[model samples]
Target: MTDATDMAAVRVDAPGTSATARLLAEAARAVDAPDLVLAVSRGGVRTVHTGGSAAPGPVPRELLTYELGSASKPYAGLLLARLVAQGRVRYEDRAADLLAPGLPVHPAVRRITLRHLLTHTSGLPGLPADFYPQAVPRWSTGPYGGYPADRVVRAFLRARPRRRPGTRWRYSNFAVSVLGHTLAAATGTPWEVLLHQQVLAPLGLDATRVRPGPDGTDAVGRRRDGTPVPALDTGGFTAAGAVRATPLDLLTFLEAHVGGPEPRDPALNAALTEVTRPLLRRGLRHAHTHTLTWFQHPSPYGRVLFHAGATLGQQAFLGFRPDSGLAVAATATRRVHRGDTFVATAYGLLTETP
Candidate 1:
């Protein structure tokens, strides 16, 4: 059931982009998305492929936007690494140390460190355990919405670790959100401002919006049946997700992970290298491995580090295979369902790239 929009997304004669366009089109069909955007990078060069109409305007191929969910974690991770490289922070720094003095922390919470948070070994919940009450009410709308920075800090103080910090790996939005706050506390800057100063601006990603908005957005998330889905509000769990970006910017972000040819501050360069290295292992049979912020999977093309993100109305996947200098970014304006294949399809394209 191809349409003009889908075919139009895959035009030929773009110097190595058409192949990616073909793959992007396949991904678009697999997910039955109203709009899809993809970008591929090889040896630091990038190409973007976009399909359908995500919203009601003229979204130039270059600026199609999608919520980047957890795919934003690596950016947070990179910021940590950069600061550490610049001697502004240390990986072993305790969360308590960076957070406000006398913030009153649980003993277990006090034990969590920057490294633990970065590696997801801090034994924190995906949200404050108590957040379930709010979640149950707005389970479909915006569970993470009403909470704010102060509430997040209060939740961190009240948190009780199920397992010892660094003892086991558990993915936690609560941990990373606190990490972002801690970084802000340590640097004397707000989280969003600090992020822009250290990461987004440095990468020239003007199209990316990690804060509340860039306003006047171009894409609207749609269901497979074409119902428009509400945009997700991260509330206080921003560092865990809460990012929206164009495919081109996502590709540039991935290229940095693969040592792209760009002049960067020494700290930023150091961070780009650090986030991709193995940092921890856990789970049954030690079957899981993680970099500072990304989930690392073994692939024929070396480590395939990737993370998938889903907002209420969009899903995005970002990954890179350093051995192959291949990075792929794919997005669709549809809610992430249990069996969605958007992530898997994007991962395959990265691994399959030569």
Candidate 2:
């Protein structure tokens, strides 16, 4: 609603050297998005601003919040990790163990574990097959709006798994959403509330939210064609791809990934380390790997841990070099072709940085 330029910059840097300037400039060119918010940090020197926050103007202000899309996945995995650390749940805990009292759960669903869901090895499809036909007509506002938690659980129970659990990797929104429900069932706490109390609140990420609220800084997303894409109503599937947050809040989360202070809870700090460590190898080439939710790319600088996410209209990226304690994040208003150049460029700068 408000022009991005009018919002204050989240962090300011003294005029960085030409090298830093060139890297930022080069990243901006690569993205082809004038309104992209780009952030880079290393050893306490950092710059965070929108390259085109004012597009065609000099002033730059933090833009409104953008849905972090699948970038939110790691948080769900972290919640499970925290639960595990608290001895509340184990990675091998079965869905049936958590959610099978009165609910009808598929036999295969009963075998699925927290690890499988977090690592995308649950063999569940990206979405329930029946979701699309029923959802397309409501695409403008949000396809999943008002889908009840109980019905969503039932859909997973009826849906068939494509492969045996943990046999192979297959990305699934359904799996994580189910994981959220199971976590709630196991802990007697709603998934959203659990995350808020255990993760966001402790990390001081007060601005990150599962659903868009009346935050004055909220930024609406746009389709490739520049038509506004209303924020998604993830409904029961909030853990899958439903977090919307300011760039600053996301950067703080990424900071924890690269050894920033852990939450005040010592158990959570231990779990944070456990969650980021490589857990499973994707049955793919070049030794690519996945942690609980992050994709790990072997880089000379160190394992470049990263994840990029896309909603129908928004794209977000979060990455860091744990070895160097360097982290970077970028976001764009539109879900343009072939993912986003802003993401690519930001990552390029990170990987190429000394």
Candidate 3:
């Protein structure tokens, strides 16, 4: 694990004056989030906040690892961009060209490009309704319990399009999950290993790993009730939202986006542009516009790039202003309402000066 003490030593300003911290502190308290960590780089800031379990006093930072939810989409976008940068793939290539021959996708679906998947314009739903089984516990160690990869592919093959590709924006976990498998086929490597090799290893993110704990590695928080939920078996959707990491490690990632050193392949810089660029306007109501993976909002400080993630009991947000080299990440155990509270808390943290 990276030294938390060393990360704390790095000078980062809070989002706002004392007021920013106070606002965030209020928000944190309101949501019952007890443990919060924030890191700012250049002109941006990132944070992780966790609500305490009723049984325990307060959740320890080291013990809290929540599902990133759709936040994992950005990493998937990065992986695809990396392939494009390496000449292994192209953005315009059809999905059928990359996957095996047996996929039963609609003819229009086959024409869907990698860009559509990254942009959430592929017209796939959040998850196939049939995949949801009442037998599965509401809050498992792994969010997608028992839904293996083969099942996911089968779901995709049988899926009927709600809208033609690129005509509209609809968030879809199934689409990105398919993208992960497509990358696996194109690269001839498991998506998990490829992500570590291409993104985490190069960045020196030692604490970030797929599937929380395997061979005695220390994992994050247990069940909300403190029942010590076993490590989640991600089954096949690991690439979608199964990776785990500490707040400080995530801060390091945000730092790299705002002019930090290229920890992975230098070629990754080219890929960053494709992944971060704002491609479409999501109808979702927010102060900012949505990009391929990141969200953009016009702050007094400048344009801010941000994204949020949520599962059963975990909530996370990453916000940054590239022009000012400022970034902020915030994670919480309880899901907070999406609006001024979340945006204000994130922006206030980003505006803080060390």
Candidate 4:
């Protein structure tokens, strides 16, 4: 059932912040979800819409939970900022110091800071050490199976970074995984609990979950060819890409970043601001940059920040326009491959929201 608040949103116009329902329908057809859920909001009012091959209306949120892949990074980033706001950790704190002394790591790796990891400038490899050789066997389904926490720690301790820390920008799943484990180490709290206490709980995203293994409730993903792709099992990289969420929860996440919705908490609001604040820039053109988590881009509507993620057979997009309080969250139950326009449509929706 549509909530009363969302039902009333039909009469409320936030101005300059929505594409007609037709565009949403078109986007749904292009992505071809079993059920595609979208939530768009501005000026505190929000509307939730669904498009897909499946029969629409109000499918229960439980069956629509989609794996959020790298899109989960923003939550990790938010957790880092929230911890900093709570005085539990600092951005400048070295990851080595947080994880442990004597990681058998090189001097440069030891010098890596939380900010470097958060912004993907830590110079660590994008995946865990020796990922392919082990993952190749399972690549078609779920590739992140063998690297458990112990193995992950062992790999980071033994492997070396190609570039010095903080010298350049390279997206590193390794660095963020280490950061997540490091946070767990530093706070004396488990990764799941800390994330829940810091980010998810405050924003009222009860349907959002951090999963390390399979979930029976979430929608099963499929490839373009219709082969089922198993959900990822991030044994050690729980912080890197283990998030799953219903469209409603994901929409609330975007709304929180826009400072919309109710049941807000003051510290979380501050941390939200900190996460979106541009920390540094990358790319030769300088047009593409990054904040703590999202990619920052210049758009005609204003500056826009977004992050898109793909599991083996699903694509997720989350973005918002802070200046206008326009936010969007979308999910497709198919993998993102070359020429896929799922992300582009979502970006277009953000900039062209009427």
TM-score for each candidate, following the candidate numbering: 0.90, 0.89, 0.81, 0.90
* Error at 117, model 1, angstroms: 1.5
lDDT of 4: 0.77
Tell me the tens digit of each residue's lDDT in model 4 across 93-122.
988877767556788778889888878888
In candidate 4, the residue pairs with backbone N, CA or C atoms under 3 Å apart (3 or more residues apart, or in different chains) clash, namely none
On the 0 to 100 scale, the lDDT of residue 220 in model 3 is: 37
The reply for model 4, stretches above 4 Å from the true place, is 1-19, 54-58, 61-63, 102-104, 212-216, 262-264
Residue 329 displacement (Å), model 1: 0.4
Off by over 4 Å in 3: 1-31, 43-66, 102-104, 134-143, 214-233, 284-288, 335-344, 347-354
Candidate 2, which segments miss by more than 4 Å at Cα?
1-11, 14-18, 53-63, 102-104, 338-340
Give Cα-based local distance difference scores for all models: 0.77, 0.74, 0.64, 0.77
Give Cα distance to truth, residue 70, candidate 2, Å. 0.6
Q: What's the lDDT for candidate 2?
A: 0.74
Query: Which of candidates 3 and 4 reaches a greater TM-score?
Result: 4
Candidate 1 residue lDDT tens string, 166-284: 88777788889989888988999988888888988777666787754545554677765678766778888888887778777777778777877463444577788888888778778
Model 2 deviation from native, Cα RMSD in Å: 4.1
**TM-score between candidate 2 and the true structure:** 0.89
In model 2, what is the error at residue 103, expressed in angstroms? 5.1
